[model samples]
Target: MLQGNTKILLLSLLVFLLIHPSAYSQENSGTIEGTVQNSSGESLPGVHISIPDLELGTVTNANGQFRLTIASPGTYLLRISMVGFEEKTDSISVASGQTITLDIELSPLVFQSDELVVTASRRSQLIGKVSVSMNTISPEELTSRNITSLDQALEYVPGVQVHGNSVNIRGSSGFSYGVGSRVLLLVDGVPLMGPDDGGMDFDGLPLIQTRQIEILKSPGSALYGGGALGGVVNIITKDFSDEPENTVRLYGGGYEPVRFETWRAGWGGGSDFRPRGGIIFGRSHQVTDSFGYWFSGKIHNNSGYLQNSTRKGFETYAKFGWDISEVMNLSMYTGLRRNNNEQFLYWDGLDDVLSPGSINLTGNEASGANDGLSDRLTILPVFQHSINPNIQYTLKGRLFGVAFRPLKDNGHISPPKRHNKGLRYGLEAESTIQATDEMIISGGLSFDENVINSDVFVGEDSLTVRNQPEGALFLQSEYTWNDQLTTTAGVRYDAYQVHTRSTATQFSPKFSASYSINESLTARASFGRGFRVPSVAERFVNNNDFFPLESNITLKPETSTGYEAGVTYISPILDAFSLKAELTSFWNEYRRLVEPTFVNELAAFQFVNVTRARIRGAEASFSVSTLDQNHQIKLGYTYLNTTDRELNQPLLYRSKHLLNGSANSVITDWMEAGIDFRAASPPERVDTDFSLFVPDAEVFPTQYITDIRFKFQVPHVYEGLDVNASFLINNLFDYYYVERPAIFAPPRNFQIVIEALF
Candidate 1:
């Protein structure tokens, strides 16, 4: 009925309407929804879900729920990842205007090589690619072993020795009465060593809040500065989790009597049974989409095994995080700890197990009460910003305070009550730049100020306060070639000013390389420089006793050069089992090594830089794990040869040969068992003249120790509650050995622990 022009117009309108409808439908996006959970059906938060090809990603919320919007209908590979868990990928298809729902379950990571550690280079990287020897202990491992202290957990590491409260790595440190520690101790990347002695109080750390512990077994002064002449131990605390957790642990144990007939003769026995108990409550929740908080508190009491050795302590921690924006975040952390303990001095003689030694020659076991109190507080705030995908920056500040008061029996003669207080404040700024796909650069600047107040060190009856300020700048770069070879180089410059002493500066440089020879083999090499400045106590301590100690302010800083080479091999799976092995050789040369030299003529001890030393060692380790990860075995051995070049004698307090072995098995769904064993050869030589009470012996005897643990998870006791009971037997063989002369090790002991989680 229309004309020719009208008819053409109508036909064009019809075609346009049909095509527009189809195009509009195609442009509509679809959504993918999913929930991430662990193998045990527990919801897992903070899981990353991504489609790599499409460059689209989202993170699961507290409830493990995630949703992604697709630009168009297509098929893509969906990937999910999280630490301590296996990665999962699946093919997902989406249609226009439709929603796809998925549920994923991830398993726990089994191999140590899969772990990502940060202490190696101050940045997160795969363990397999790290050029230095390192070790990691996870929360699961700590819980399974029923470990209650940080130092107790480190004893299993190869080339490490825990004598009393001191930590020795590769024989880098001898017994110095806690004056200096070559190894550095850090909590959440913040140094906690005492300002006076440069030693740390391992008992003050909140082990209940720890998530993991990483040990870098190589010189780290190029990045960490002083107190890292030997190595570094970094304790990483737990972050805020979406779910709340509460735990209570109760344990009771006892000690065995002295084994030797001579030692048993003087056993001034008390109640042999000791009891320990603690409770921890932690909770974290999302206040808003951009805000979250976590808090925990723990209290513990221990009726120690030895006479007059009792301890009680409590710790509290809190953390808060705010997401300022998509590219910025701010966080704050606070921690406090307080403890009181009765100290036990060394044995009076080898024949007496209960006769404690006295600092004064004319004093008896009960002449004075040796007791002390320790308190610590820490505060930290951090800000992080991402300028771009490849550039990031962080700013952090920390404040730490420690107060210690010791009451000795001979206060009248040597100042009975001495108070020591240390205050430390520091600020750090760091930046990381990913210049390219194969290269990265990082740098940091730090400033630290230490203030110490003490009466015993500066003078008796006079309170003195001193300050030491330090600054450092460090830079490091890592480059990868063809994804098979990687090299890292770093350097640090540090300057420090003592209150009334001289100013000093040090330059440390380190270089390391790793090469992947094959799919299962990797080789690594490293060379580094390390140095340590004298502690305030080392240069000012003045104690008047039978074994007097006089500080020397003319002491120089100690320095060392270290080199190491290692190879690792991961064998292919055979019959649902696999084996991993590593071998490393290391050499270290120290100049101006510090030690307390006894002046026999004056009957005094002086801290001096008097020795040039060389230490060479080799370590071998092997681990076996089943494909199902239900059974595992680990073995490690270390051989060390140390020489004091100036004295032409072997270094003191170091074992020439060491062996460690452990096995863990999940025998049933709810039952797990583990065994740990250690053996060490005696020191080749010791300085028996340092103590008259100790027997004069050129060589100490070898020692063997073993521990066994079993844990049973109770089922269906209560809804939404988990309960576990553990049994531990330490020093299983009842072997009697001395860690230090006249200081016998703890005999066989038993502990029963009952823990509940909700």
Candidate 2:
């Protein structure tokens, strides 16, 4: 009953299936099976096994088992790899119409120089092959150290400094309240910074769902867009597993009392002793053969050391994935968070070190109210399709919303009583083509729109809102001349419309080259251009203070160029020991740097592009580990020189020298201990022109701090249950120092954590 054309098509399809080499080979393919285990004879999931020549690979499931089908029977080399484990290679013979089974046992990796990273080039590649400087922190490392916040985790990275909520990388940024940020923060490749102020909210990130954190210590605007003028921090969340997994953690800690009793005077007569604690839960499950889901939640509370600084927050996250077919896939993520806290603008005077009071706090209102509350939600969806063996495309989109309320501000006479809300949506499409075995090209187009409504920022009588739109196009390529030489180049063009009126455009370009001197050594050099668009707050803020700040409609964007060269040596294991070292030097030049300038005649301040600056720095790090990976040591040092070229003076709030070190050892099968230490040569200058009540303070002095931690693990007492406990002592020596002008670092503190896994 079929038509003549339909019959002919069916016949041709039958003939193609019967005679095609691919179809015939698949019908007669052989099967390969394998299991992966660690040195302790425990199943290790997520191990990747591949036959490189055939361009085929598979990851082990929850049971550490994998199965592969080969199109033909022949001899091949099998390569197996996993992070924190030594790689393995083996020669095997495959017979037609036969099944081959093999088992592999891998040892712990002493030095993780070969770990794979994706943020460097937006593609998976060995860390050792990346041309830029970077650092990674794993979930295991976080657990061992009992780190609960992004800032705490980043402190361990070399050439990074955390001051309150701001991060400075290699002296690239000084303090700027909350207006602008040089370092960009990302969660699973999506920007997480607040669009209103271009500031990062470390607490908004779902730390409970993170598997790893990657820090790129170089400008990445060529690939990441704005707010990456200095560097980028990418937090990669965990993926779903084939089997069910659950984890729960609870931690409690307390801060030491103020050092000088006089500093706490005028505050409440009650004890200043404060307590903090948090609870985290995470779970993952495979719904079916091709579907998976992950969920995590966290609740935290802190009775801050300073008066009227208490805070409480909670966050929840979920992700779902579906493998629609062999060539297409889809994934979606959603998260919600809410936080409430008392605001502590600054100290009332030079002597009130531990007290919390703003400039407007009068003697009669010592215990007045100053509070802030925030709620946020985000949703992201992604789809991927493979058109052929060498071509693929991806589409991703995000929707984010934030509501912030300044409940009370005792500092201001008639505290605005403003409720600010912001909404943002973005979409991007990308394509990748493997032109040849040695060449790869990728291109992407992105569009974003943001809208904000506030009674304070915009005029109260004006019903119109502020909107900003952006668009970008980018292209990147990688080429390899041989096994020892490789090069990468990328460029991005971005256009932005501010206040639905003025338009601005920028072009960013990046270039890098790497050459392998030997199997264990590599040298690399890179150059890049970066820029940052002005934030909404910077252009339109009405605080109505003594030195009121006025909006600047003609403010220009901040731009910079940077260059870096580095050499890395990854030593091969020798007699159960290995060593890795890296040395890097970098220089950056900035033009049209945005900063607040005071117009003395007008008795007002305005944000303007009025300065040129330069920063040069060098960093060195060394890591050594034992064969069993039970003992390890790391050391790092950084030296920086910064100058305001136009002002002929040193930059403010930037340290000239820094040193950090850590050592860890497995004391027994169930116990581990570690020690961490850091020393910083204080800032060479301080900003005194701002009318923020900051005193005429001099340079900070050199200071050293140390911390010690011990962890104990208990094997499964019941089926599918394990427990771990940790004790940490921070600032072991109880050294007191000031990180910012009047902001003193906390004295010695202690924390305890308990974790259960199933």
* Deviation of model 2 at 495, angstroms: 0.8
| Candidate 2 lDDT for residue 547 | 29
Q: Give the least accurate 10-residue stretch of model 2, judged by summed lDDT.
A: 360-369
What is candidate 1's local distance difference test score? 0.76
What's the TM-score of every candidate structure?
A: 0.84, 0.85
How many Å off is the CA of 93 in candidate 2? Answer: 8.6
Q: What lDDT score is found at residue 170 in candidate 1?
A: 84
Candidate 1 off by > 4 Å? 1-112, 260-267, 284-287, 359-369, 408-417, 459-463, 545-547, 693-699
Kindly list the per-residue Cα lDDT of model 1 for residues 1-758, writing each as its tens digit: 46988999988877554323223333578888877777755565446788999987765543455667788679999999754467899998998888889888877655434555678887766678789999888888777776777788888898888876668888888566535788898877777677778886675445456778998888889978998898999988776666665666676666766555665556445324456666655566657778888776667787665566778888888888999998799998888988877766566655564555554422422221256777888888989887754567889898889888774544222242467888989999989765443456889999998898876477332447778899999999887664468899999999987546588899999999999787678899999999889888787777653246665778888888999999998764755777789999999999887777777664566788888999999999999999777899999999999999998998878899999999999999999999999999998877655554333323357989999999999976898788899999999998878776556667788888888777
Best by TM-score: 2
> What TM value does model 2 have?
0.85
Candidate 2 lDDT: 0.78
- Which candidate leads in lDDT? 2
